[model samples]
Target: MKAQFPIFDICKLSRCEQEDIFISRLAPFLDKHQNLLLSHKHTFYHIVLFTEGAGSHDIDFQRFLVRPYQIYFMGPGQVHSWSFEGKVDGYVVNFSTQFFQSLLLKADYLDQFPFFNGNVAEAVIDLSTNLHPLILDLFEKLVHESETVQHLRQDMVRVLLVQLFIQMDRLSFERPVHQATAYNYTLLRNYQKLVEKNYTSLKLPREYAELLFITPGHLNALCHEVLGQSAGEVIRDRIMLEAKRLLTNLSLTISEVAYQLNFADNSYFTKFFKKHTGLTPEKFRDGLFNQLSQDALSLQ
Candidate 1:
């Protein structure tokens, strides 16, 4: 059977102009608990700002806790899930890659910040006592402006984000050279985000180069310089992750999964899946189910 990737909930996407948009979803998991049971791999990447509540988040195979005043940046293709302790209060800021445009964080530099990576992961942050007030202040202004001065919310959100980004970038353990590449980082970021969203649909580096007005070779150079992987690698990685999601998550037959991912036939899907994970469709499915059953029995 072919594989299909999970779909995201982000309905619209604006260009990389302005700062960002804010929708204060203060309601957490209670009666309002709308858990996104992705029966498949998730597609639209987004972020989470925890205002209040305790929860555990699982990204791919990693697990972490979510605390208050913490922010996480997630990208388009990451397989993630979360469970809140009773009422989980937070803001689900589902922004497009266009908004995250590689300006602030390069794809390579962002490897540690899984929240921002397109593969989909939730990061947790619990700022020290000295920095708590700063985040609180920003959150207050964001909520206040959201209610009162609705006009200036976008700019305020930008400032708040810049604060968090700066702090997180500082706390990162990367060397000074890696941290100092903030210059024109957003341009690279925009390019990266563009590719993450459209790489599957838009083939060829030149296609992306055309959109960015740069040559394909130059774009490839930049990708390798920053991401340590070729542009094609990044694209293929996203597609492969999506394919895995479809093959493993949903119970759809291989043919359906293949068509959803735009593959021409089951043979192509099998070849692609086998290329990434040396196992054929039947073997992969059997292994996944076997693992799940073992986990279930262990819990029992």
Candidate 2:
């Protein structure tokens, strides 16, 4: 039998009675869990802010250079690993999926934040010099609240998190272009959510269009206008991303991966994977292992 990839939960990482959330300073957290340097998946949402640090962290196979005043967010089930060049310190919070459901009126309130939408590109943020004090203050309060047994401590933490998210979202808007109107943006986001939920079984833009009550042409045009990709390309990209993620697990063979992705056979899967990624599934897996081995050796 092959070894399964590690998946950690907030309950296992914290001793709090609720076990729904865990918060700590980054340096101590790293000292306690050095194994985090290796790739692992988390069952809880993760937020980290680097007050001081220098290193690289990988999220879903995408590597990002670490810097001071940088914050990153990861939703459940995303694979991540870290490597630090020197002393690293920050604030880290891990919370369950249901952490805010009871406190907030909207069950999907967290999804409104772009960082939590599973787009790695938008998830890691670098704060401007002027915004540094504000961001730092919020994190400091969060740490203090987590350490104290005060009235409505959890509620306070939730409020702080929402404030932090709103601040970041506001910063994101300062970018040069905001093409989609409010109605179109909501529609596009909803379409993306559907694709994420049904990517494995539904492999066409038309299928997703029907679910969204929009014509396939409108869907394709919206994707191209906002995302610079066709609707079909978006679906294909999601399927390809899942394929890459599943391939990372050494326990599963290529054929097994195909079956899980709803492909009829391994051959077609190989063709599709290679055509999109320029590497066969076997080669991709082999290269991934080799790269990991190199990373381990470098650390040693």
Every candidate's CA RMSD: 8.0, 2.1
Clashing pairs in 2: none
Q: What lDDT does the true structure give each of the candidates?
A: 0.60, 0.86
Write the residue-wise lDDT of candidate 2 on 227-300 in tens digits: 88899988897888789889878878999999999999999999999999899999988887776776666756
Question: What global local distance difference test value does model 1 have?
Answer: 0.60
Query: On residues 158-194, what C-alpha lDDT tens digit does candidate 1 reach at each position?
Result: 5666665666656542433243256434445667677
Give per-model TM-scores: 0.55, 0.92
* Candidate 1 lDDT score at position 286: 71
Worst 10 residues of 2 by lDDT: 1-10
